[model samples]
Target: MTDDLLLTGARVLDPGGGRSGRYDVAVRGGRIAAVGADLPHRDARHVVDLRGKLLTPGLVDLHTHVYAGATYWGIHPDPVAWYSGVTTWVDAGSAGAYSIEAFRRAIRDFRVRVPVLLNISAVGLTGRTGESRDLENCDVDLAVATVADNRDLVAGIKVRVDRETVGRHGTEPLRRGVEVAAACGLPVMVHIGTTPPRLADVLALLRPGDIVTHCASAIAAAADGGGPVSPALREAHAAGVLLDIGHGSGGFAFDVLEAQLAAGLTPYSVSSDLHARCLYGPAFDLPTTMAKLLAVGLTLDEVVAAATVRPARALRLPDGIGTLTPGAPADLAVFTVEDGPFELVDAHRQRRYAPRRLVNDATYVAGRLLPPRLPEPPRPWIPLTAAQRQALQRRAGTVRALLTAPLVGPEGLAEQFPRQQAAVPLDPAAAVREPVADPVSEEG
Candidate 1:
């Protein structure tokens, strides 16, 4: 009969619905009850003052690898999701038919939403590359059956079409991936990388509504590196192929993206492609990747749509996953939209400045606020710079000290017992402690 939660006095932004204003959002039973100035109840079980904050639909990252512990690229989303405001993480090509069951089991414990793009190769992205090199693993029938059985989980198909992944096999893996998607009546997402099969051949196999991740990849678009956009890319953009900025460690380039924008080709979705390696620096999280788009001249509305509704449209996600419309999933993100000449970096290490930025303050999934989660240390195979290694060590040390030290001194404690000798200890020796230099916090 009453709302479960009421968030009042904030700038509500629903790019998918093209609605933006200072409005109150109500949540009930883990779904958005209403989004307007007035509600049925004057109060709720819990009310939060969201004054001066920007509230929007929880971000939907279209490309990520959250199949942790089993694959090389996988990284759990919760560690970053809570702080980054991403509720939906699309695990693109992280698992395939052979590993789909295992992948399902692995993700069962994740706190955030994980929609999958079944890899064409049965082995999936278990290693760095070459998942599709063995054509036997690229079985279309198996992939189709896998999708059919798990229709709700499998968003579409994903194939990494590159020289290293396909080896001498060329475009066969991509063709097979397309076949599986076609049979299942789903769009296929193709990852473009190093040459040998040529970007043109890869693009030729794709149909409209299909996604081309890493569209501005430096390696994949190397031929048009500093120059204008290529004819093949131009034609694909004209033909309705959706472009996604899969900003992985080596997949994004400021120059390339800039060129694309100049040529009137804006990315349909902005994704971090967050994996184990890039999670620390380049593609830190979806918000950071979205910031890169902001730096590259996209307005806040456009960037929000790219990170939310547009990606949802690309995947055809259900349950109003990307909007704050009434009756939609009560997934929300609140941000402190800060004034900035903020410096943001791309995968190529190039920098740009933006006039304003959205820094997350809180993330909510299903109307429940997400608690903080510490990220696991990088895998032994993950390469880190000297500075990064030292930073990790310092962070660990700080956390250790913070948790290991006594929470309160005797002076701050109260007597818990009323028995004789329940008096607090005030001995000068026990109360007096050696002076230690305060450790200057290194975190910003």
Candidate 2:
């Protein structure tokens, strides 16, 4: 209830400084007052026990579409933010000069910190194909003016270099995006997938601080046919081009990611390209994307750094936003690492079982304590119509026979019938339920 609060007994992990230990963090007037084990909570009006939780800087998602009701692929930020341990949502090219005012209006009352990347295209992502196909839409002067007008909210420029988005324009759109970013003295975050100008060409044009998102996309061609970790990419990384994992529905591929990691090409930041389509499956949330990285051999500390400190530095966000340092804003995420047989999926539909997953326990924004978004309570099975029940029984019987049949080993089970294995309930009666409407289908 009070602005001053004390979080005690948390395993404090500040990946920014490579510090990890149990500490008591005190907050007052929305800023961190002190952080140490012996800090007295006598002056604090509110005290929270975080004994079993890991407390780190508030998570930062560098790539997201939070312009809900404004963009077709956008979703509200708060629901995905607090729930996934993110306190900062960086809108990645969801709004351009045309819609940025609406985007700004939408987030004016939001609790989460929203910094936007102004799209190069004047229309942004309002169309079915994308915002950059027409050369007319790539208005450099308007974009530069927009960034100047909204200096506080605008972080950088965003451009998609994929073939489908840019069409015959090739790297011209990227050129315009870079020009606007240069004029505004900001970094440019380029999205690369199916490339006509090639990923190497995109990389060559980017400056040191510029970011190439979806670096692990399988659609990206290797510069020298060596592997997915192209020679140009390695050179670009050396020259300071930041590589970001914008794991959207079609961006991340397990094979490509594994190869890149194996070849020592670790991403500078990890972000869920959280839009409508990928929000449910594959790219579930920022935490899930981090879990996928964990599954692929990134250390817990490494993964935390990618989601926190690294992204903050990349976006040039104000200090104290991504660290639990004393005198910083009291934005924190408390999580518990659950031991698991947890199944994680990539954008390519490849599955990997992680030994552990970080589950958010609670979050604190500014100095306000917020509840973690909990899973919905299981609904009671709705009684099915007689015909529907009979159909379900028959379906269950067929599945049971297939699961028990010879040649359906563990490998075959996962490979051959992935969807059926995950979908079927053990009890046939439980399977005969009414379909629930998708929560995200309708506009807010």
**Estimated TM-score for each candidate:** 0.91, 0.82
For candidate 2, write residues 1-444 as lDDT tens digits.
Answer: 343888899898888756799888889888888888767767788888888889988999999987766666777767666667899889999888998898888989778899999999989887545678889989888888899899999999999887789988889999999999889889999998775777778888999999999888876744324468878899999999998999987788878888888888889999999877666556879999999988888888999999999999898898568888777788889899898868888877789877788898877789776653322211123223476457657766886687687965576655554555555447776678887788788554
* Candidate 2 ranges with C-alpha deviation above 4 Å: 1-3, 222-226, 371-444
How many clashes does the backbone of model 1 have?
Answer: 0
* Cα RMSD, each candidate: 10.6, 16.3
lDDT of 1 by residue, 1-444 (tens): 788999988898899867899888999999998888855446588888999999999999999999888899999899898998899999999998989999888878888899999999999988999998889999989899999999989999999988889999989999999999999989999998887798888888889999999988988887434333788888888999999999989999999899899999889999999999899888888888887888888999889989889999998999999999888999999999998888988877899987788889999999999998888889899999998899899989998998899999999999887568656768798667886666675342
Which candidate comes out best when scored by TM-score?
1
- lDDT for every model? 0.89, 0.83
142, model 2: CA deviation in Å?
A: 1.2
Inter-residue clash pairs, candidate 1: none
Error of 2 at 423 (Å): 64
